[model samples]
Target: MTGPRGRVFRTVSELGIHYRRSPACGVGSRSPRKGPRAGDRLPDLPRGLQARSSGPGWHLLVSGPPELWPDERIALVLRGRDDLVGVHRLGGESPWPDVVQGLVRSDGCLGFVARGADLEGLRAYLERWLPAQHG
Candidate 1:
C-alpha cells in the first residue's frame, strides 16, 4: 500500500516501521506516544543544558550516572568527527532508563539510541551511518 509521502509498504507493520523511522514525518510532537525512539526529535534539554548549533552535522547526547558514562575511546571518536558537533553530557533526570546515549541530527531528530553506554554499538552505528570520511 502507498503510504504518506508516496512511500509504499507491504503491510501495516511496514507502515508503522516507516513512521517510527522518519523524523521528518513530525511523529515526535504527536500524542499517545510510548516514549522517545530513534527518528523522534530529541526531547527538550533540561534547563541550563544548551544544545549547540550543529549546522548540518550531528550531536551526541550522553546521559546517566557517571558509572555508566561513555569512555575515552568514544569521546575521541566523537571529537574527531567533522559531522559531529560535540558530545553533550546531559544532567538532571532522564526519561529513558535503558538509553544512555542519543545521536541527534542537525534537524533535531534522534538518529540512534545506545543502551548501557554501549560503546561498541555506538561505534558500529557511527561506522554504518556517519562513516569516517564524513566525520
Candidate 2:
C-alpha cells in the first residue's frame, strides 16, 4: 500500500494476495533512484519467515535452509507475541534499518532471520544456547 523504500514492502500469505503495489504494477530499477549508485542490496539479504493461512504458509529463501536453531545470530523483525517465549523487538518501518546494529556481521557467518513479536519467547531461546558446566 506504500512505497517508502527501495524495497517495496507487502505481506503475502495465501488467503488471497496482498501487495505493496497493484499486482500489475512494477517497481523500477535503482537507476531511477537517487544518489551515487553502489547497486541495490542482494535480494533477500534480510530474509524472514512467517505463518500463513494458504499458499506457501512457510517460505524459505535461497540462503539454503536456515540454521533454525535457538539463540542463533540473525537479522529479524518481530511484531509481538503472547504465546512466544524468547522473541524480541528488532526492526521497524525503516527499510534501511537504523535500530538494531546486531544484525550486521563482520565474519558473514550469519545466515537467515526471523520476524515475530514474542520478546519472552526469544529470551527463552537464547537461554538454550548457553554453555553447560560439567562436573
Candidate 3:
C-alpha cells in the first residue's frame, strides 16, 4: 500500500505462508457486524514488549536482552521474517531492561505507551491495546 508520502509497504502475513492485504489508508476495512476486519489493525506485539513515548520521542522497551530474557528472542526472530511492515534497530547497546528497539506492522505502525516496564506493564498495555485496536 502507498502511505502518506507515497512510500509503499507490504501487507502482513504469517511467515509468508499466508498474507493479509492492507486497505488504502492502512486502518483496515470495516466488517458488516464485527466492525473492523481482523486485517484492519496491527497484530499484537509479542509478549514482554512495550512501545512508548520516551524522552527521545518513541522507544521500544524490552524486559531484557535476548541473552537474558528469553522473551526478548521474539523480536530477534521477528526481525528475520519477511512478513513485517517495518524494522528498526535500537542503534546502541543498553543495559538490561532498558528500551531496546521498535517493531511495526505491515502498515508501518508501532504502538506506544505513556509509561510501562516489565511484564506487569505489558499486561496492562495489552488490556488497553487490544480493545483500542481490535474493538
Candidate 4:
C-alpha cells in the first residue's frame, strides 16, 4: 500500500490538506486493529464523549473542557478521532492566547476549551457548548 497514492503532510502550513489520514464511518472501531497498523482513522468514542452528542450541535463530549474549539481544529480532531478523544484544557499559562474570558483560541481548533477545576469538569463544559453548522 505504500505508494504515491498515499497522502503525506510535510509542513505546518500544509496541515489543512487531506494527506495524513482517512475518514471512518461508525460508532467505534470495529475490531480494534493491531499496533501502528493501517486501519480506520476515527477511533471509538469513549463512553464519556458519546453521551454529549445526544443533544445537539457539535458537542465535544470528551473527558475535558473543549469549550471553544474552532471549526478548523474540530476538523483536525474529526479527521482522526472522529469517535472519542481525550481533550485537555490549557489554563492561565499555555501556548494559546485567551480569546474570551474563559476560552482560548489556538492556531488550530480541533478542540477549544474553558477553565475548569479538573479534567472532568472541562469535559462537561465541552459537551454542554459546541457549535453546529452545515457539514
Model 3 pairs whose backbones collide: 28-40, 52-113
Question: Candidate 3: misplaced stretches above 4 Å?
Answer: 1-64, 72-98, 101-106, 113-117, 131-135
User: What's the best-to-worst order under lDDT?
Assistant: 1, 3, 4, 2
Which is the leading candidate under TM-score?
1
* Candidate 4 residue lDDT tens string, 23-114: 21111212112211111121222323223233322333222234554445555534433333333333322322332112211212222333
lDDT of candidate model 4 versus the reference: 0.29
Model 2 Cα displacement at 22 (Å)? Answer: 38
Candidate 1 minimal-lDDT segment of 10 residues: 24-33
Residue-wise lDDT of candidate 3 within 1-135, one digit each (tens)?
257333322333322222235322211121123211223332233422223221232233333234543545443433323232222332223222243323233332334221112334323333343322221
Q: Write the per-residue lDDT of candidate 2 for residues 1-135, one digit (tens) a residue.
A: 345432334223221222323222222221112211112121232333121111221111111222332233432322222122223232342222322111111111111222322234333323342222323
**TM-score per candidate, chains pooled:** 0.60, 0.19, 0.26, 0.19
All predictions: root-mean-square deviation over Cα?
9.4, 15.7, 15.0, 15.7
Q: At residue 6, give the lDDT of candidate 2.
A: 24
Worst 10 residues of 4 by lDDT: 35-44
Best by lDDT: 1
Instruction: List candidate 2 segments past 4 Å from native.
Output: 1-107, 131-135
Choose 1 or 3, whichever is better by TM-score: 1
